[model samples]
Target: MSPRQRDRVRSLVADSEAPIDAQTVAAELSVHVTTARFHLNNLVEEGSAIAINLPPIGVGRPRVGYRLVVAPPVDDLMLMLVARLGETPEQREELAAEVGRAWAAKHLPSVAIDAELVPDPVVLAETILTRLGFRITDVVSAFGQHEITLCGCPLEKIEHELPEVARGVVRGLLETALTAGSPALAAQYAVAVRPAPGGKCELRLNLAQVADSTAR
Candidate 1:
């Protein structure tokens, strides 16, 4: 998993006061339900979080959720790792790019690209993110790039606490979507995801001219 994915999982699990379910965490984290479940289970085994059964409303089996159990100390290994990475901003950014490229290589095969340019890649991108609970307010094209406006942070308001990792996840999401959704334009390009007004996030896809390039 990428740093963003891992950190967001830990953040959601750590910050919550009550037990949180996989579906809810998935939406807030902008990750698949399965991804959230996978990481949550791991955290449970690590003793960082604990799993509990939610009282059923009117069902045979109760629902399961995770609650934060402990906090990583200031000198914790993960904190130290993040600090070390922060020491080299350029390398950290490159690693973030690779996280996106690697994710694209994994999921793009299933996205069904076409021979011709597809109608706004943003549409498809929105669908994927929406399923993970990252609500899309609007999407538009201008200045030769697709702009997507999103509401809700999958990290559950912990984005500023770990901005690089949070942005890294968005970076991967946009890059992968653009590459898979528009193979014809899968050439080298960059994207930016920023916090927006009214508690939203903005994605600006800098779709540039195609050039020979390798995946990050």
Candidate 2:
């Protein structure tokens, strides 16, 4: 089977609100039932998806269903905020950053700021991104800045459709994480999301020159 087809099947499982059976997968992809089952089983074996017993629909035996092992939580509030907040794209993105900040504060681990302890922003970034189901590809340090490349965003669909808002979300998450660790260092750095060579996105942290700025 083609890798793209398998990825599509995985995406279908990730996007669905309810568990999907082989029959449903076959119908959706217009593939044979055996082919669908094969892909679903492969996903289960690979630990990306799981098989579960679905509720019986007036039948003798319950059907088995496939679902993502770690399905990303749907953010209906983000959509509502997007629709109600702003008239223009820029306004929406600006407001969305606030929403993202609040989200990161709630979801990310609480940090105890210590004056003596210097926090590594990249570590905090990895913690938050991994918790949010993003796959980080590479982290490069150059020119007094660090660039983190990531793919397989949990909110891939939303990121694709609302790029401005997506950028806001990413920006807020990074900024808030940095601030929690060290307000001084946070002020010295700026976060920007840029497109990478492949489908990956880069989180570039631009450091501004300020002597002893990180020292507390």
Candidate 3:
């Protein structure tokens, strides 16, 4: 595969939540297994993905799978959205808010704002979502409120069983997220942990209207 094709394959793998094999890649990309293997080996050699060995229950040898270890670029998505909105400040703001709302819908459990504490909740919301492994797909702002759309899971594991190291990682991430355009905006930031359906965990932040937003 060419470099561009390899990059596209990598993006697909990152977007997928589970490990995949060469055959699966071939089918997904409409390429032959040989071609898929070529790119997979190249990615492994470059350390972009790791080869995982899974043993079958019947005492057979392990099968190989590939897992992505890197993330796709946010700038690419942002640039596309910018182009779509045209070259106007109002359009840009609208896009930014749209992005925010979309992000909150997919990634956050729920969001509400302590308007008395922060001037711009959308920016704060985006920061938190980014920290949580959700990429900002789009953004817009209206009447002082910002909206964002997001995808991906920075914290995919169950929260109750989260290790200390994981909690530390999230805490550090939250610290970064809490920092917005100004100290006042930062002070208003807070994330609430709640139980998600199907026994999963979700994050609720102190930003408004996130639940109503949907991911793109």
Candidate 4:
């Protein structure tokens, strides 16, 4: 279907530990079962997630569920920091950059991975986040804009590390997705990262003028 829909499915599948049936996904997203199924099929086809068929219970037909198959572990620090970024848009980039620097300064001290081996900044950030267990929940596109939301990752541990490079990576990913024309509109873009009550982090994009102003 739409890019936004695919993003949403990615988010949902990433968040789930086990296979999730269409009914559950529909309920969480407030969409019709058929709509959920359509998106799930798309995700499966894209190789972003996997679909599992359940054994029949007794009465009717068996149900199917989808789960994220290619995601990495969830990082507690990244989750918390991303969530906090949502509260203030005026300084999101600055804040994200600062967070990234802080992370490098602190955690990088003991990390032994070669710099060259690290994926490109954006992919590395996404990989670290997925490893930290963040899930994609929604990809919204309206009025010529694109935005994505992620949930199910703890944000408390790494709030201090979010700054500079980390923020840049997040912003870059949003730009990349938008440049790819994930959204049908041609407008300014904004990315919001926040955490929910259940240790779930929400990353959203706003295509409204507010987004345009912030981008400038």
Query: Could you say which candidate leads in lDDT?
Result: 2
Candidate 3 differs from the real structure by a C-alpha RMSD in angstroms, to one decimal, of 17.3
Q: Per model, state how many residue pairs clash.
A: 2, 0, 26, 30
| Candidate 3 Cα errors over 4 Å, as ranges | 55-61, 70-216
Per-residue error (Å), model 1, residue 95: 1.4
Cα lDDT tens digits for candidate 2, 70-101: 64555665566566667876886787688778
List, residue by residue over 15-133, the lDDT tens digit for candidate 1.
88788888888899788999889999998888888899998658667878998776657535654565455556556656655765675556543755676755466665675566556
Residue 145 of model 2: what lDDT?
A: 73
Roughly what TM-score does model 4 have, to 2 decimal places?
Answer: 0.31
For candidate 4, write residues 1-216 as lDDT tens digits.
468766776788788878888888888888899988988987788787788888666888888988877655467545654657756544665666555444433322233444234223233334444544556565555664444456533432343354332335445444443333323221343444443234323444343334444344
Which 10 consecutive positions of candidate 2 have the poorest summed lDDT?
Answer: 200-209
User: Global CA lDDT of candidate 4, please?
Assistant: 0.54
Using all chains and alpha carbons, the TM-scores for the candidates as numbered come to 0.49, 0.56, 0.31, 0.31
RMSD of 1: 16.1
Ranking, TM-score, top scorer first: 2, 1, 4, 3
CA lDDT of every candidate: 0.66, 0.75, 0.53, 0.54
Candidate with better lDDT, 1 vs 3: 1
Residue 200, model 2: Cα distance from true site in angstroms: 6.6
